[model samples]
Target: MQSNAQTPDQYIEELPEDRKIAISNLRKVILENLPEGFQETMSYGMIGYVVPHSLYPSGYHCTPNLPLPFLSIASQKNFIAVYNMLVYSDPTINEWFVNEYTKYSKAKLDMGKSCIRFKKLDQIPFDLIGELASKVTVDEWINIYEAQLKR
Candidate 1:
């Protein structure tokens, strides 16, 4: 579900008590491990980590006015979702994440193209997510994003 909150802090504050901690922890890990050049902001009605326009003036292809989104964390209707563009855009990263997920949690990976869903909050793998956030640099993501656009 999308949020109407204007800031990341506000978004977290509005979540149900059951979800507040999990989403907060997820946000903590992402912000701590996310590489420099990526800025945290409220994006697409979720807490988003993006490559700001100062670095990539083209912004997103679909929404050119907005910054290039790299990752986002949202509390969905039934689960908390981590939307990671690196896993969606790069096959190597996707393969690595899929393989590594098994090492972190016993629960089956509930995932979409880029959205990793955690129905059981206790099973969320914070470290794996953090490492994934660190795997791609701003330059790399921009390159990968541009390449995909050309295809």
Candidate 2:
């Protein structure tokens, strides 16, 4: 769940072999499709993709000391997790992801408001994950996050 690793590379390197592979694959897909401007860092003890402070100086708003987080992938004690703040914040994206995942995945969708959990690497819906990562740019995420603050 939480990683004390200072960097994403360190986090991955510290994982057990099997977990490293799964996290690495997931990280690859995320990086390949991630919208520009989101930086990868270690946050909340996990490998996180965030809208940097330079891009959104207000920081996380909830915790201004932290960067505005967008997504994260981690190897937990029991299973791996993919956390997507965009899906949690946007009902439309959440609905679409749920529907598409159920329709296409053989693996069960174990998810919360923002975290998707799975025991195996293949259980992750790579295509859907990539799409979700690509849907929102940094500027768009800032607008959305700021709008929510106003509400």
Candidate 3:
């Protein structure tokens, strides 16, 4: 697949203040800890980072773009979301995420196949979200994808 023309700086620059800050902070956390080779681009009108198809030809199959996203973040009309496919595969992880998120149950949750949604930066658990991001290292992602393949 061809690389996206949209650069991270350019993408963030076009965002509104609230979204920009949210995306910027999330991007900061991701870049600081995520492994290199991950690329950010505009996908479906939201900010998405993934390993290119060049690296994972079958697609971060488990991730949005296939073979890339262990983590994904997005800005929507009503919320910001972070998706972790691994959580869906692990009951323990989902349970723990729910438990951790209960501290703010009043916040809305927009869950998709693998996305978690929240309205504000404060609604997200910075430390716990970071922890969730950390859970998906390269080895873990391959293992998770391999396990999914068997299913």
Q: Which stretches of candidate 3 lie over 4 Å from their true place?
A: 1-5, 35-45, 51-57, 62-66, 103-110
The TM-score leader among the candidates is 1
Candidate 1 per-residue C-alpha lDDT over 50-133 given as tens digits, one digit per residue, 9 for 90 to 100: 999999999999999999999999999999999999899899999999999999999999999999999999999999999999
Q: What global local distance difference test value does model 1 have? A: 0.95
lDDT score for candidate 2 against the true structure: 0.88
lDDT per residue for candidate 2 within 42-139, as digits (tens), equals 88999899999888888997799899999998888888889999888888888989898986588878999999998876677777788889998899
- What lDDT does each candidate get? 0.95, 0.88, 0.68
Consecutive 10-residue window with the lowest summed lDDT within model 1: 84-93
RMSD of 1: 0.6
Query: Roughly what TM-score does model 1 have, to 2 decimal places?
Result: 0.98
Which candidate leads the pack in lDDT?
Answer: 1
Q: Pick out the ten consecutive residues of candidate 2 with the lowest summed lDDT.
A: 119-128
